[model samples]
Target: MAEQTPDSLTSSITSRSTTRRAVVGVGLGAVALATAACSTSAGQQEEKQSQSEVTPLVDTRVAFYGKRQAGIDTPAQAHAVFIALDLCEGTNTQALIRLMRVLTADAAKLCAGEPSLVDQEPELAAVAANLTVTFGFGEKIFDIAAPAAKPQWLKPLPAFDEIDRLEDAWNDGDLLLQLCANDRMTLAHAQRTLLKGARPFVTVRWVQDGFLRAHGSEKPGETPRNLFGQVDGTVNPRQEDGTIDRYVWGENVEGLTPWVPGGTSLVIRRIHMNLDTWDLSDRPAREDAVGRKLSNGAPLTGEHEHDKADLEAVNELGFEVIAPYAHIRRAAPEKDIERILRRPYNYDLPVAAASGISQHGDTAGGISQSGLIFCSYQVDPLAQFVPIQRRLATLDMLNTWTVPIGSAVFALPPGCAPGQYIGQQLFEG
Candidate 1:
């Protein structure tokens, strides 16, 4: 990729060739630091200062070494790429350990706005944009590494025959890499670098790219809207309220995991939204389907997004304000323990005909195939996630417009300190 030259600096430099060399040099730490007492021109000092200062957008960093893995509790970035890979045949515990070390080291550097040790495009590494790379392990990984340490709930979700049209292309894998960033370039670079590092031990199984509102486009704390135009994640647990701590982090929950305190389970469902049929439905029908106001995502009987949903409230004709089969009603947790942290992203890709690459059965005679990459994190999938999914699968009206085409469950290990690699406990514990 070509380096972007600043217009201000471009005019000051003489020839294009010289300007490129100068810009490259400036980017490569050629800035001259002059004290106030030093004899340096004011313009040169200003230029030096401008080159040194990085915008917060690009400079933001999420620590790669932590108690818990990032990209889970961290605020959602504008873009994400979920990569699932299967371990190469004959990859044993020691080989897996080596693979984790390599990938973890790469993640540490990339998340800190540095390049991989073997980075060919080091220039792209500077724009971290709050990049985070999180690792997950599938059941196959444990079978190879430490079968005894595998959690009982670390397997594929129970078959939801009625609502799921499962496709192998997006299904199971031995490992998972979830990379997110506010900048697509940073996210892409991190993905490439990590995948390159892991090529020796694993082969790519599937890649799902997703996005939401770009950075700075929406106000902080505002919930993101899905492709369906409904405000998503309104019912998510908040870190300040201890919901995230109790549910997502599994503070007091028993049967939490073979990996806990700093570990969680991730459920990825690639739900394809039938925009063609959804567009045909009327406003009231749409609102009734989701049991939330289209304008603000409030419950049918409430005025604000966060207002308690009046499930029993009635209409003028004596009908329940929130329908029994409405999505919000069905998706609501029956018990406090049933809650999970949802962090979904929207994906709209060109149709097979347009892109000349067919994926699953996405040739809907439209210009694009759009859907939500439904991601949820919890301590235990069977206890916390499955119950809610069962309710939705049986009788959520939104099911008419959405079909889950892909599903995978992964065990996310705790973050590691310096000199340690992710999932180290799983192999060593």
Candidate 2:
């Protein structure tokens, strides 16, 4: 080659560099396309596998006709709606009987995955999802239909000035219907069907909707955590051990209400949780308030969730491991008869702008309203549920973060056979 000028030499070098970069860019572009194709294929395959593995929760069913209603002792479903209705003017004994008969038949049909006779949306009832419909009678119900069957315990809970900030809108009702299911669609359908069927005989007083962890999210028999991140309903009576029969069902038990054989009482309290203040507290302080570890809900002195809390256990500084004012300690039943079967559900909703008040009456302004629908079932509310509640209301560190805003008590009659209605025993006995 001839001796090249400086400009020629520079041009030759630049051309070679450009050609090399072009080749590299083409190679990189091909590799990127291949990688993207592989990623897309893998993602599609994973999604398809996931879709195939999911089991639809539609076919499962719980029996509707039995000695006791299904929802009280049945496993707590993921969704629930507690509806309170008042008897319409001029609703008499005959009308009450007719209402119960109609409601019972509708409930039986819904629980069996069939629509109610007046169901407007029959397709929604196709999924059973373990639907259960439980009926309860308020004091007025007994006053109108069966005065002699009225249990003394069927009244509003005693005032707890220390913790209760009762609201009239949620206080009491003449009739109560508890609808629970693993699916929200099923629950909503059941609620609508029941309410529509009874609309002619009653007027809606209030409706409280609540929920727990989705079905199958936790293993069977696992205790659920509340909004405050504490395990709730840990110390409930076990059905398999006959505690339910003795404490809840009260079958042939002496000294208990005669009207409660195979029947029970229900107390529903709307407890608002102040999560804004609770979130400010430290983890140790939170656990101390609840008297259990946040990790697994074990008592401070124990390691397992069900471990009996050593109420007398102390630490190095001679302080109680579980504080004297702790929630679990205050809520513990002093007598075995004081125990009640608790089935609670958490509720959360976007705070309404008009009120600006949180569920706990915290007007400091919050983004959400949240609370627990505290439900307890027993043979007698006065004997079993009230005593423990009084203890908690007297002194519970949790009082700083929780407040009861609504309360009601109802007598839950025993279940009836296929041909009988829910409250037939009480009315016709």
Candidate 3:
């Protein structure tokens, strides 16, 4: 996700590099100042200012998985890796900070001179170019934190009656770490590097590999294609310069203390598609539900995916061309249709043989868990994202195939300069 500015490319590159270096140089001293300032009541204003000035370590997005196809055997089950992490007992805050620094450094090294983090997965190579590291924890885990220490904005999501399996996954080992990159090879390389160090504090609960299709050059503003042969990320925020403050960071007024000053909030949902049931739907019905051709992501109203959707256009019978409750129609935000940005990836997991399970079947078949690790970043989750998601969860025809199982939220602080650790604000009073 490269930002285009009015400045010449050469100057832009040069300036950005210089700015990055300067940020790294000042980050550590600033962190110390912030910690000290927060300790004294008289220095509260200075602490706030120092905190505000510190940049985020990475621009992260949240990704979650919903266990819709948990028991079903299918082809998409081979790529899943379950991950679980135990909170470090009496862990030093500085240790966590050092871990982030080490991980970020390793990511930079893996990129081979490129500043952007790379994803090792071929399918995700492009999306991974914009490196984002995301993580979250459940509410019960906070009880384990020391009396004066805790992570910020760490809490349990509103429990949904639809799935009960996630409760154990949450309480047993609550933290989830997601590293998004464009190249699978890069992602693999980075993952191995992080694991070398992360193993001490974080444990791999489940690891699922997935891919999201590139927004077609032929179709603009269309839902993205996934490996599962369905369009995903139809209604997402547009990645653009100057729009970050609005789309990623909510306004800092009205009780909301902007967490990541220049960054945005990432909401990720790992939805499992019931491909068996989805495949059972007739082609016509499937096309009708999505309001487009399944083979290609083009809209019914137009031939190409980028063509403007005609929500009100009528069919030959005078019926609305796009069903009123179609996924795209319901997911689109009414006021600012282009406010949300989605960078989705697909995952296919192979199933394992267990009690009463047959040995001869699709090697990829066991529990097909491939689906979208839906990620969106917005300034206002309640205002910009919730409405759209609520509508889809309640009424979109696709819900029959998708279900929400796991969810978590985190308030990402701004990036820190080199030498400074991530999440510096959590320690500040």
Candidate 4:
């Protein structure tokens, strides 16, 4: 049982297929079988195999909530607690590791119900069970002499104008601590758990917390409508066997290290949607704007949401039934769309009193601050990701519903064994 490295994983995915279509057939079956077989062994072999399969494409159970019915909602809950942290002085990787170790331990304690560090802020503690901690390396994350000389692909997006604000937030302990519980009590408990360890390294940036009504009247899921009330992310990547590596990692880029081995880059954006104005657009106009259904996210050509889109479908007048420039159509054009795995959680907040006044109560009344916490994982953020986002940012009709406010790119190093912490590669370098 050899310990897997990023290089080995990248080699495995690249050596298998040349095109995205090839990812689905025999190649995927072979990988799945191989992974299953490797899982049989008792030791390192099993662990390594498991690591190889942990791609972002897998179904990650996600629940979202907002602060309208604080004591009463199910499925999803929400809170915005701004956090800030001071950077460790030197290039002491051990210090950073220690910091994370302590942080994780506190996180566990909070979730498990120790003394309850966040008891004072009951809402924060209630949301701990639904929490996930991730780390990123800034452009300066790697010290000089690190392997491959800080891959050019690792830099932040050119469109991210708020680099300073983002850095400040991260350094200031910026983290989204989510609480996934069915009842208000459970949500409150989770929040208490998270706030315990989070308090030392992070401080509240701002606190606006509450719960969202369950996804539907019957079951929990994404909001029927996006922030704009139009269904979004309907055409997201499906959770299949071998598709993770392709969607998470890039195709044929060379020299770049795979931080998380089989895992890919998770790009998170806080996209603000103009629900007030978006809700005013008529159905036909809205459909024309996005070239898809306002309900199920189906393409304008009547293709099922999950079907391979038919860009060629056109009306009798030769007008493309699905607008040629529609978000989905352009995002995944008939011939050349690169797909990425999306795991988004919805967020809704109450608008500030001042901000809420402008809408004259026409909005969700409470200044409904709802948007998609857009998280996508890809192998090469630079290649597969940036292009699509660039397109969306520049010309997608849905941009009318969304505007990216905060952004950060983190290189997720592979998951480490029990005694190990993340970012072991930085130490080796």
Candidate 5:
């Protein structure tokens, strides 16, 4: 079993290009030190420090190391790329461990706004841009590593009947990494660097890129709208006061393997929105499909978006104000543990849409492609996400315009403390 605590994680700096280490060590070491000092004292001076003193090019940065992964609960950044990798032939437990140690070490440095100890272009690493890199293990990761430590829900989706088309290219993998940031260059650099580290042990299986409203583009608390123009994530679980603790984090779940304490499960579905055909539907039809208003995202049965949808309330015609087949009605949790925290991203494939690629294929170049990378985090996929998905798959009217082409579920561990690598508990157990 990997020990509960490791002594060497802090030392896992990517060997930054040794030739440049002399110069970079002095430069980046100061930046990392200042960043750490700021973390220790949460005061006004720290909060209101001169803009000139901080790295001018990148102002916002989410701490890379914490109790929980940053990207899951952190407000969605402007850009993201989700990549999955298949384990190379002959990889075993030891190889997996070595690869993870290197990847984890590099991820930590990049997350903290420092170049990998071996970073070639140290300048590019300076733009923190709220960069966050989160890792998840696929079901196959367990088969090769500690099979006994595998979580029950860490597998591919079951036979989903509503799916119009599914492709192997986007299906399953041995690993998953989500790279997010506010700046495109920073995001691109991080992706390239991480993939290079992973090249020896795994091959790229799929890459799905997504984005939300740019930071400051919308009001601070506003929910982002999807390509369908509906305010998505209208009913996400609250992160404060332990609501997220209850639904999204997995420390207290009963009967869980030791590997998953303080960890969670993730679902990533690439739902292709048929904009060409959706444009044919009228405003009322769209509203009926989602059970929310297009203008302000209010529930059909209520005036404001956050107003509870009166599922039982009747219209003058004696019909329920919220239609029985509406997305909201079907998606709302009917019992405890049915709710999941949704953190989805809107995806509009520039080249595919502009060039007329077929949308059914499981790739970015698929024709007429524009949709959502529908992501949700939950303590248990079976208890929280599956039932809701089944309801939507069977009868929701919105299914007419959306097709799930790619789907995956990953087991995400909690953040590592300074000295430990992620998933240390799993290996130790």
Candidate 6:
């Protein structure tokens, strides 16, 4: 069999009379063609054909260069860590430039399955494992570059009523590096290699880590289920949807905010979840809290996970079926433009007995330090994220079991081209 072009594949599929949809990836010259059929024989034939061409995990690699950062739009990997760092006492523009250049070169090689220039264990880079290294700027970065022109929104998030206690250790930083990969070893090597290069110029501020089911654990496209056992990231924008221009890139005009074209804003919140108390709630109560079923994540008013939530539905008593303060109900946007892309991961940490912590902390009190690194990306968080969060802060029922403990924001720079550093435009544009 010869390699089929997208057009040729669509034409061939029509001959078989099976339904198919093609999603073209920009600049990729490839179409993800999905086929469906009513006949068992046809389905089985397609399944067997797919099994022969399954992509090996280690063989998969994501390019470090593009119009947008790779990890932002790319499918979430199995393992990830978000690291925050602060500049050394005397770090200057020249030192910052050198740091960025080294990271760029190291990331290029590491992402392409080659050892870092100073890699002690070259074999560790053997399995690139779809690894990606994304860089982000905090307010301090701009202060170092040019204090006069920093974006107005590049400041600390305003205090929210829902926030019980925000820990400074995990709250803010001057620089951010989001490292993701299918394998932890591969991710660790990449992180160490880059951090080693930036060590003299910066210090570790905070490290928030999380993960999902590994590759091959389930269907590739299935949304990951969080520790709460609810399906996560169901409504994210597809990378090839072409809607990223409206939702994630501000203005879509070059140098709109200091070479910020294709760049997006990131919100990172450490939401502590009280699972012990959550476990006390029965199945229906848990489902009711989230406005979705515990089994398949379908809305209470619908039968499928993707079914439109019937917010207006009521029962015999005339009470809202989705609940007045259900998380989904409160978080749902009334207008089209109010939506933001959510990319979150579950995090768990044991409370040390040395700290004299207890287990049954309850709702208003703190949990044993386990939570979700609730992260999102938007063109302007001021418009897209703040409003919905403000609403949730007031009366969302899920807030009883979850508390915001850490909060920070970063400016995700546009992607780099070959031989260009991640934030090259910020200095040169």
Which regions in candidate 4 have their CA more than 4 angstroms from the true location? 1-91, 107-131, 140-151, 160-195, 198-225, 249-257, 333-337, 354-368
Compute the lDDT of residue 170 as modeled in candidate 5.
72
Higher-TM-score candidate among 3 and 6?
6
| lDDT ranking of the models | 1, 2, 6, 5, 3, 4
Score candidate 2 by TM-score against the native. 0.86
RMSD of 3: 18.0
lDDT by residue for model 4 (1-429), tens: 122122232333333222222333335455566666553443344344434543221112221111111111122223222222334345355555555565545444343333344356544443332233334444444552244535455655666332112322322122333333324454444545445544454445432233334311212234344455466556654324434434554333343334445334546565555566666668888888887777777777665765555778878998877785687766872223356666555667656663442142232343456666565666667766777777666576766555565565545444334344445555554
lDDT by residue (tens digit), candidate 6, 1-429: 222221232233333322111111221222123333334444555555544444555666787777777777666778889999999988777888999999889988888888988899999997887788988899988888766646677877778965457878789899999988888889889989989988989999999988888754555556788888888777665545655556767543232232267788888988888776777788888888889987887899999888999999999999999999898998888666566778788887765542433244342233456678888887767777887888888878788678888899998888888878887777665
- Tens digit of per-residue lDDT, candidate 2, span 1-429: 222221232243345445544544555555566777785665565455444433345656778888778888787878999999999999888898999999999999998888887777899999888788999899998998778778877878888888888888888999999999889989988888888789899999999999999875554456888888889988897765777778888864565653556688899999888887777789999999989999998999899998999999999999999999998989888876888899999998776573433443472366657789999998888988889989998999998888888999988888889989988877776
Assess every candidate by TM-score: 0.85, 0.86, 0.62, 0.63, 0.82, 0.83
Q: Which stretches of candidate 3 lie above 4 Å from their native place?
A: 1-84, 112-154, 160-176, 213-224, 240-245, 251-257, 335-339, 353-367, 425-429
- Number of the top lDDT candidate: 1
For candidate 4, which ten residues in a row score worst on lDDT? 64-73
Question: CA RMSD for every model?
Answer: 11.4, 17.6, 18.0, 14.3, 11.6, 8.0
lDDT of each: 0.82, 0.82, 0.47, 0.47, 0.75, 0.75
lDDT of 1 by residue, 1-429 (tens): 121111121222224334444554564453345454452454465456544542345646777888888888777878999999999888899998899999999999998788889999999999878788989999988888788878899889999988888889989788999999889989888988999999998899999999999875554456899998999999988776788877888886554543556888899999988777777789999999999999999988989999999988999999999999999899988887888999999999876555333233342455558899999999888999999999998999998888898999999999999899998877787
Query: Which lDDT value does model 3 have at 170?
Result: 26
Steric clash pairs (candidate 2) = none
Q: Between the candidate structures 4 and 6, which one is better when assessed by lDDT?
A: 6
The TM-score ranking, best first, is 2, 1, 6, 5, 4, 3
User: Model 5, 21-131: lDDT tens per residue?
Assistant: 334345554555676666445333333442223223265567777777767877677799999999999988778777777788888877667898778887888877778
Best by TM-score: 2
